[model samples]
Target: MDTTVNGEPRVLATDAAVALIDEIRRDYPDILFHQSGGCCDGSSPMCYPTDDFIVGDHDVKLGEISGVPVYISASQFEAWKHTQLIIDVVAGRGGMFSLDNGREKRFLTRSRMFGGGEACAIPGVQKVV
Candidate 1:
């Protein structure tokens, strides 16, 4: 599937991320990420938003991970462009690429605790549904 963030296109995952995007696109009418400052693991997982969010410079705009619309920041997007974003199914499913000091960086999420949505674990590598 084609992944685009902030109107830019990039291949984030081999298939897992793409598949998820595809599934969400079909049934989910509203798609976006809940971005914040930090998390226990230095950053939080991207989640389906309950409201509208603005694309910011610090946010990574993920075109489509697993066919789901993901919005990240420009900084995060630039960081993961040339690196392989590893999608670990066990630690939850979706993905976002990041470059930490010129090296490929990856963020994976299964359950997000924001936006009035319950923290639900998602499929390991399946497309969003």
Candidate 2:
């Protein structure tokens, strides 16, 4: 799958992550990701069945990985707007309430800062203030 939407990608997934996502999709066809900001989950990416969690109006959609939409709270987006989120799978427990819970591995969020002259090109992401 293409890692980018237009010219740049705001989010991406590793091969392992894509495999895990495909495994999860077998059980839950419609799933999405929400990047938690240092709450109970300690900044891990939370996965859920699309209808299970509500996407708040202030949340920003950061494009898709493995065909699943990824989002972050508007507040968190401001803090991470300059980085590209790389979704990876690691050996550990997932968030207590996340769909990946109970699975042997969990989804992890890794990131890299955008280079000079490279701006966030994803649609719907606007500069806040």
Candidate 3:
């Protein structure tokens, strides 16, 4: 429920996303998501068992999406800080390493920029290396 401008927990989920996350939890209760900066997954939000991916100082915790911790690269955070990320589920295969893969559905991240009063107070995000 926390939405600090730059703080962790900036990412949120839609009903569909939450449902999908719950479904994934059945098999992998400790899963998490990291927005791919590029390369292997082409910026898709990749899901994995939390213990699988290593969070480093360069990664910033954006927030929790559907109870799953969501993180983005520090550089991406600098570019996307003004926007709010909304996680959703769409029909398709996700990144091969993502837990959602092979499920006929993939997790998606949609974003919108803050407006008006909110534009000036984009909160700071936190990082857990």
Candidate 4:
């Protein structure tokens, strides 16, 4: 699946991330991908089951990046509503999809803006293998 980012087209379905998402979907059809407010350094990416996984304000195709529907926080969904976003599936030692753009800034795991670190933790989301 390709989406525009920074006015350029980017592929969101990476081989590794897509495979992982497919496996997880077998158990949990509804999942969410978000970054924890802050962690050791800054914000960290999070993937897990969500009890309140609303579409927010984003109108992204749920099946584009596999059957697992993608949803963002209401605030985040609104923030990037105007900007084109590509959900690139990724996997590595660190985490999942990495938000790449000219602006390079680490996302804190326990960001105060994201409702602190305590609220960032997911119930069943495991690290991508």
State the C-alpha lDDT per candidate.
0.41, 0.82, 0.75, 0.39
| Overall local distance difference test of candidate 4 | 0.39
Q: Using TM-score, give the best candidate's number.
A: 2
Candidate 4 Cα outliers beyond 4 Å, as residue runs:
1-11, 26-30, 34-45, 50-64, 89-129
TM, every model: 0.40, 0.85, 0.82, 0.39
lDDT of 3 at 11: 72
Say which candidate scores most in lDDT. 2
Score candidate 4 by TM-score against the native: 0.39
Better of 3 and 4 by lDDT: 3
Q: Which parts of model 2 are misplaced by more than 4 Å?
A: 1-6, 116-129
Instruction: List all candidate RMSDs to the true structure.
Output: 13.2, 7.0, 6.1, 13.3
TM-score of 3: 0.82
Q: What tens digits encode model 3's per-residue C-alpha lDDT throughout 7-40?
A: 4336767777787888999999998888888898
Worst 10 residues of 2 by lDDT: 120-129
Question: Model 1: number of clashes?
Answer: 24
* Lowest summed lDDT window (length 10), candidate 3: 120-129
lDDT of 4 by residue, 1-129 (tens): 234333232113344455565665676667665533344423444455655444445344322345444444445545544432233332223333432211132222211122122321323222221
